[model samples]
Target: MSATIKYDDVETGQQIPAADYPVRRVNLVMYAGASGDFNPIHWNERFAKTVGLPDVIAHGMYTMAQGGRFVTDWAGDPGAVVDYSVRFSSMVVVPDDDEGATITVSGVIDQKLEDKRVLVMLTARSGDSRVLSRARAVVQLA
Candidate 1:
């Protein structure tokens, strides 16, 4: 087990450093194929435009999963997340390029909870938009 992060050591207003998450076209396709979410809006730019979206959009769940990965990496275990939620604030446009779209995720410890838990207010931004709003997670420190 990794060293436990003590809840008492964290400050309420401390901002967690932003972490970059790379989402390539292939990654989106794989996520679609794996998750069986073959929404045309996710892969077909023409369809996305027809629906009034700026460009091909990524799956909301895909973005959420990426955020989950970020939190898990910090906690050193996926199971360490006690709760997590987010509101879709904006769509993540995925262009067909090598750099892909990078989602920058950051968080702040909003409050300390009993029993080594803390409420973390999260932010997920891509390009100039806030993709995940009202985002928060309850993480259990080991």
Candidate 2:
């Protein structure tokens, strides 16, 4: 594991470079198969509309994973993320087309704790809607 990020090198309110994660129908379908979440709303627009959604929506965990990537990428190691949480505030309505939706993830160092650990606050959005809320990750630094 590459835990090269030292606590002293980071500062509170330090902004991590934002990243965009594309989500096509095929991506969702693959995620469904991998996660055993074969919910029709994630793959079928008809079922999604029947449930009163704007269109077929991406999974909440899928959106959360994008935010998690923001933290893990900054930490340089997936295992460095000791804690993570988020609230599903909005839906990521993914359309069935070549150009699908994109989840934009951004993060900032919110706090520096003891033992070379820091709290990262994350924001993930799709289109005009904020899909994830109160997303935070505790990463163990070098």
Candidate 3:
């Protein structure tokens, strides 16, 4: 499907509405199963502490996927995203509780490029920690 957002209608520096994704221990377990990462730090709090982490952390790729979801959801089509990348800046600690942790994602249109594409800059934060840095996506618009 084509993107609902047209390149001609978009402006640089426009803000996308922020979205929050909650990460729970069970979600981490499911992600580990699906991804085959199965790393202790991602699922085992004691093991993670033994390894010098504050608590069980979410997988880096899972965190990146949330940022991608934010971009694709805004673009209105997953296929609209032609390129995406991010730098892992901090860990998302998932506590074994009902609230768990939250990853808040927001984006801004950084530049309008040729070929109906735009450069989007993304920010993902969990509490006071900046979970992603240098996050960007190139999306093809209608």
Candidate 4:
């Protein structure tokens, strides 16, 4: 489906409100099972520590998906996003607790492109550490 947000309604440098996504150990475990990326670092705290990580971490792709979700949710259509990419800059450490950790994602309309498309730059952070770098999505707006 096409995006409900029109390209003319958006401007370069306009801010997209930040969204928080809570991640827990169970989420990582479910992700591992779904993705076939059964890496111990994603769910096993002890194994993660042995691998030099402070605690169990969320999968990089999972974190990236959160950023994509932010963009798609804003655009009002998942199919509106024609291109998306990100560089994994840091880990999202998930504690074994009720609150777990939170990944806060925000975006800016970086550029207005031809044919009703716009470049959206994304920022994803877990606590003070930026988890995704160079995150960008090109969306086809209505």
Candidate 5:
């Protein structure tokens, strides 16, 4: 485990550098295998289009997990997280061909709570669409 991040050191408006999470077709396939969400919308383009989707799409939770990973990785500890939430604003369209999709996530310290906790605001974007909206995380710092 990495060293714990201190809450007192963070300032409001402090920006966490954006992270690019590339999601290729292989990633979707791996996520499907790990998450048990083998919905064709996540792997099979034909099935996705049959369901009226533009192409195979990533699972909402999968994208959310990436957002969480970004924060935790930055904070240096997963246990530091107290709360996290996001609204599924748009779909992450994953095509069957290569070049796939990439979701970029960024964060900022928004609010400081009592007892060494901080509220964070997050944004997740894929292509031109925002996949997660009103994303927030409350973390407990050491």
Candidate 6:
């Protein structure tokens, strides 16, 4: 937690600083092992192509978690997030390279709800595609 965001200072439509999260093949393998999502499409390029996908892709939940990190980081505490959701809108293609893929996440306060909570709308992108849609998080602020 860097600095606490007070509810009194927060405004609807206020933008949170955007962040970029990088995903590599090793990350996919690790996430697969940890999450038990061992689907080949996440790490096997041949299998991904056989399934009609463009190279290996990052897990949807992995992408969502990155978005979650963005919100929690902004709130300055993971527990500040009361609710979070996102719809998978596009695939995040992970290439077999050092750079891998980058998911850029940005958010804004959409609405201030009751009891010191605000709805945060997030935008996530990989390359030219929007990877997540209807992404939102309800955060509790001090």
- lDDT values for all models: 0.86, 0.90, 0.94, 0.94, 0.90, 0.95
- In terms of lDDT, which candidate is stronger, 3 or 6? 6
Report model 4's TM-score to 2 decimal places.
Answer: 0.96
Q: Give the best candidate by TM-score.
A: 6
Provide the lDDT at 135 for model 1.
Answer: 90
TM-score of each: 0.92, 0.95, 0.96, 0.96, 0.93, 0.97
Per-candidate alpha-carbon RMSD to the true structure: 1.7, 1.6, 1.6, 1.7, 1.5, 0.7
Residue 62 in candidate 5 has what lDDT?
93
| Residues 1-142, model 6: lDDT tens digits | 6587889998998998889999999999999999999999999999999999989999999999999999988888889999999999999999999899999999999999999999999999999999999999999999
Candidate 1 error regions (>4 Å): 1-4
Angstrom error of the Cα, residue 123, model 4: value is 0.6
lDDT (C-alpha) at residue 124 in model 1:
96
- Residue 23 of model 3 has an lDDT of 97
Per-residue lDDT tens digits of candidate 3, residues 32-127? 999999999998899999999999999999999999988888888888889999999999999988999999999999999999999999999999
- Which 10 residues in a row give candidate 1 its minimum summed lDDT? 1-10
Better of 1 and 6 by TM-score: 6
- Clash count for candidate 3 is 0
28-83 per-residue lDDT for model 2 (tens digits): 99999999999999999999999998899998898898888878877888789999
Candidate No. with top lDDT: 6
What's the ranking of the predictions by lDDT, best on top? 6, 3, 4, 2, 5, 1
Task: Estimate the overall C-alpha local distance difference test score of candidate 3.
Answer: 0.94
**Runs in model 2 with CA error above 4 Å?**
1-3
Tens digit of per-residue lDDT, candidate 4, span 1-142 = 2347888899999999899999999999999999999999988899999989999999999999999998888999888889999999999999999999999999999999999999999999999999999999999998
**lDDT of prediction 2:** 0.90
Q: After superposition, how far is residue 92 of candidate 3 from its true place, in Å?
A: 0.2
Runs off by more than 4 Å, candidate 3: 1-3
User: Least accurate stretch of 10 residues (summed lDDT) in model 3?
Assistant: 1-10
Report the lDDT tens digits of candidate 1 across residue range 1-142: 3445667678789887789998888888899999999989898889989999988888999999878877777667768899999999998899888887989999898988888898889899999999999998999985
Which is better, 1 or 4, measured by TM-score? 4
